[model samples]
Target: MSATERGESKIRIRPMEPMDIDRVLAIDSKITGVRRAATYTDLIIGDLGKIPDLSFVAEVDGEVQGFLLARRDYFGEPFSEEGMIHILGVEPDYWRQGIATRMVDALAETCQEKKLNAVRIMIDERDDQLQSLFERSGFRRGKLVDYTKKFKK
Candidate 1:
């Protein structure tokens, strides 16, 4: 269903601005246990290869309630470009409100506009809610198992 089909509450979805970095950081920390607000800014600027308008925010009442980071990339050998859902978070208070689905739709539209081959996402094993959302967005688990390593400096 479209956002319009889901009723209207003045939800404004738009690209992220410098002013949104702080709230985006807070939301990221709350959802992911990552607290690198400074590094996030740098990574966004120096790495990520993200287009300015593809990273977005969902707002209501003039406050940011959600954010989405989408990017397009190529594997070393693959001669094709694919889209990635690098990060997405909706404020805890706004859970189960379809904010995520809306963000996914927006990201998909952006990817299509840019002629991406496909959009992919990686979700943590424990986040059932987000997993459900991904499924609702037509994403299925691929053949790969998710792995990560933690290091301390």
Candidate 2:
């Protein structure tokens, strides 16, 4: 069911602004434990500066509850536009209230408006809750491996 069908009221989704950095950082740090405030600052300012429509925040009762940052890029191999959901976080107290789902649906709507070929996101293999959430959102598993290599600084 859509967010509206689930009786979501007093919850508003709007384009993220630079003034939202503090609350966004707090939510991100609380959810992920990665407290690098500068990183989120750059992301919010830079990404929104480029494509304002790609970033959004979910607010309830005028308080920021969650946020999603996404970007669109064009790939050349098959020549297609794609949308990537880079980051997402919802407050612990608001969990299971379909806040993230609503944020994603909003992003998907923007992607559709931009004519993106697909929307993608990377989730940790052990995150069953996230996996289930995306699955319920009509996302299917794809055959791909996420590899990483760290270099000494």
Model 1: how far residue 111 lies from native, Å: 0.1
TM-score to native of every candidate shown: 0.72, 0.78
Q: Which residue window of length 10 is worst by lDDT in model 2?
A: 44-53
Which ten contiguous residues of candidate 1 have the minimum total lDDT?
Answer: 44-53
Give candidate 1's whole-model lDDT. Answer: 0.75
> What does each candidate score in C-alpha RMSD?
5.0, 4.5
Cα lDDT of model 2 by residue, 18-85, tens digit: 78867887887787766764665356557545534478899987899999887776655766788877
**Can you give the lDDT of residue 139 in candidate 2?**
84
Q: Whose lDDT is greatest here?
A: 2
Candidate 1: TM-score? 0.72
